[model samples]
Target: MDKKDRFTEVVKTNQGLIFKVATLYTNNLQDKEDLYQEIVFQLWKSFDSFNEQSKLSTWMYRVAMNTAIYNLKSGKKQVNTIPIDLETERFAEVLDKTEEEKIKVLYEKIQMLNLLEKGIILLYLEGKNHQEIASIIGITISNVGTKISRIKDKLKSQIKTT
Candidate 1:
């Protein structure tokens, strides 16, 4: 198949992954759509560079997470992350009420965190190990562990107070 076909297939298959990243990084529908488009653009831009050194999902996560982080840091592109209308929020696919509730709470808390922290926690919740998290974030394994602990502590405090 041609590059376009391959890229299209990959994007279609991984649309959920992109949507989740976009949702986690944006405040509202407009912002989510914007980020989602930008991430797709980025993935297309970088598609040729995927060296097969890691899993396709891992590469997608790295790219999508980096795009989200960049969007967060860019002053003109910055958008508020406060959860609004979370009852109306969608988690990409249908989930049980209890599972959805837990995810919603976790998302609310993650939205409160900085972009970098959100990336780490998102990866963690997605079942990425410390090494994978560190690699994606361009940090040390030890640093990932430290940050995970710190993030856990912060989440605990936030959970208790909320």
Candidate 2:
């Protein structure tokens, strides 16, 4: 396939992954949609540089995370507190209602995290390994482990106190 075709295929297969990253950074539908579009634009612009050394999903995660981080830092999109009842139909299909509710609660707590911790936990939730998280976030593997442990403990404490 040509570059355009390849890009389309990659995006089609990984759209959920992109949306997950977007949702982690955004609180409302509008901002989620905007972040998704920005991520796609960045992916398309950077497609030529993707050398297949890493999985496409991994690269997409890196790009999406970076874009979201930049957007957060620039104040282009302030993170809002996501309500538990907020509809997330597009990305909620994988889970049944109960699981979805649990996820919503988890996300609510996740929103309390700092930017780096948010990225780390999101990647961990996505099942990315320590090495992959480290590479994507530009940190060492040991640091990834350390951060994930701390973040998990923090989340656990938050859940207990709530």
Candidate 3:
């Protein structure tokens, strides 16, 4: 396929990944949508330089995350509240209310994390291995392990207190 076709396919396949990263950075729907668009724009702009050494999803994650961090640091965006519990009854019906409440509380805790910790935890929750998380975040593999351990401990303590 041509470059355009390839890029289209990559974005289509990884839209969910994009949205997840966007959600991590922004709270409300409008802000998340804005961040998502910004991420997509950056991804398309950088597509030409995306070497195939990393998996496409990894590259997408890195791009989306960098965009998010940059946006957060720029002071141009406001902190907004996440509305994960605003979904309709279908989700509520599928998940036990207790499970849903736990997830909501987990996300609330996640919102309290610093930017780097948030990225690390999101990658971990997505099932990325340590090496992959290290590669994506430009840290050593050992640092990824250390950071994950600390973040998990912090989350556990915070969750317990809440």
Candidate 4:
């Protein structure tokens, strides 16, 4: 396939990854939509140069994560919260009440984290292994583990206080 076609296909397959990253970093619907487009544009800008050393999804995640982080830095956080979207509603539909509450609490705690902590924890929460998290965050594999342990501790403390 051509580069554009291949890029389109890859993006189509990984839209959820972008959406999640955007949602995680942005505080409002407009910022989320803006971040999503910025990520896709960055992916396309760097598309042809992406070598296959890592998994495609991993590369996509790295790009999306970086773009989201950059967006968070540039944009102001809105005080008003967004209503849960349809995808979240669909996800909550299957989970029992407890799991839903737990996830909601975790997400709220995550908002208190710094940018790097947020990135590492989000990747860890998404089931990324240490090496993948390291790759995405450009940190040492061991550092990823340490950061996650610390982030968990921080979340635990936040949970207790709230």
Candidate 5:
């Protein structure tokens, strides 16, 4: 397949990561869409650099997380006044189940975290090992463990209050 085909395939397969990460990061629909698009764009830009060194999903998650966080931190103005679209509303509904309810709550709680905490928790929830999480976030493995521990406690307390 050509680069365009490969890029399309990757984006199609990994769209969930973009959606989930965007949902966790932003409350507004426009912001979520913007973040998702930015991530896809970044992934395409970095597609040529992807050697078979690691799993594609893992690399995609790292790129998506980094792009979304960087865009959020950049303080660029986004038009977020409109209500969320039907798809995001449906997504919120689907994610709000009893088992997933806690995860949804945790995602809400994640908004209170600094970017580092958010990145760590996102990777951990995505089932990335500590070493992989550390690699993605450019932190030591021990730091990833420590941060995840604290994040869990913080989420527990935060959830209890709501």
Candidate 6:
């Protein structure tokens, strides 16, 4: 494939990485779009450095997640300050949550988690193995398991309280 074809394939295969990271990082639609764009930019910028040592999905996850966490840590975005209109708020509140709502709440709860925890949880939720997750995040495999356990428990508690 040409460079453009390869780029398109990468984006198509990994849009979920961008969307999920954006959702966990920001609550508002506009900020989600901004985060998504920032992640896309970062991924494209780093594309040349992806030396095929890891799976494309794993690399995309790493780039998107690191971008979100870095933006959060740099105080470049405040998820809570994003305004929601009354109509939208009511719609969001009243919408009958099917499986999708459950996933949304889970994602929101994951957002409340710390950056590392969020990374671990996101990988776990995506069904990545511990070793792959560790490789993506530069953590040990055992640490990935331990963190995922703790994150799961923390998310359960957060869900209970919410």
Q: State TM-scores per candidate.
A: 0.81, 0.85, 0.82, 0.81, 0.81, 0.78
Model 2: clashing residue pairs?
none
Pairs in steric clash, model 6: none
Model 3, 95-118: lDDT tens per residue? 987998987887888899998899
lDDT of 6 by residue, 1-162 (tens): 887689879897877667778878776767666677778878889888987966888888888888887776544554444343323354466566695577676666766888788778778888999988989889999988788888778867876887
Ranking by lDDT: 1, 2, 3, 4, 5, 6
User: How many clashes does the backbone of model 6 have?
Assistant: 0
Global local distance difference test of model 1 = 0.83
- True-structure RMSD for candidate 6: 5.3
Which ranges in model 1 have alpha carbons more than 4 Å from their true place?
73-99
Give Cα-based local distance difference scores for all models: 0.83, 0.83, 0.83, 0.82, 0.79, 0.76
TM-score of 1: 0.81
Q: Which stretches of candidate 3 lie over 4 Å from their true place?
A: 73-99
Number of backbone collisions per candidate: 0, 0, 0, 0, 0, 0
> Candidate 2: what lDDT?
0.83
Give a tens-digit lDDT track for model 4, residues 1-162: 888898899998888888888888877767876788788889999987788886897888888988886776767655444343434566668999999898777777888999899988888888989988888889999998899889889878986887
Better of 2 and 6 by TM-score: 2
Candidate maximizing TM-score: 2
lDDT (Cα, tens digit) per residue for candidate 5, span 76-142: 6755443434265566565646857776656667789888898887788788899889888998999
1 or 5, greater by lDDT: 1
Off by over 4 Å in 5: 73-86, 92-104, 159-162
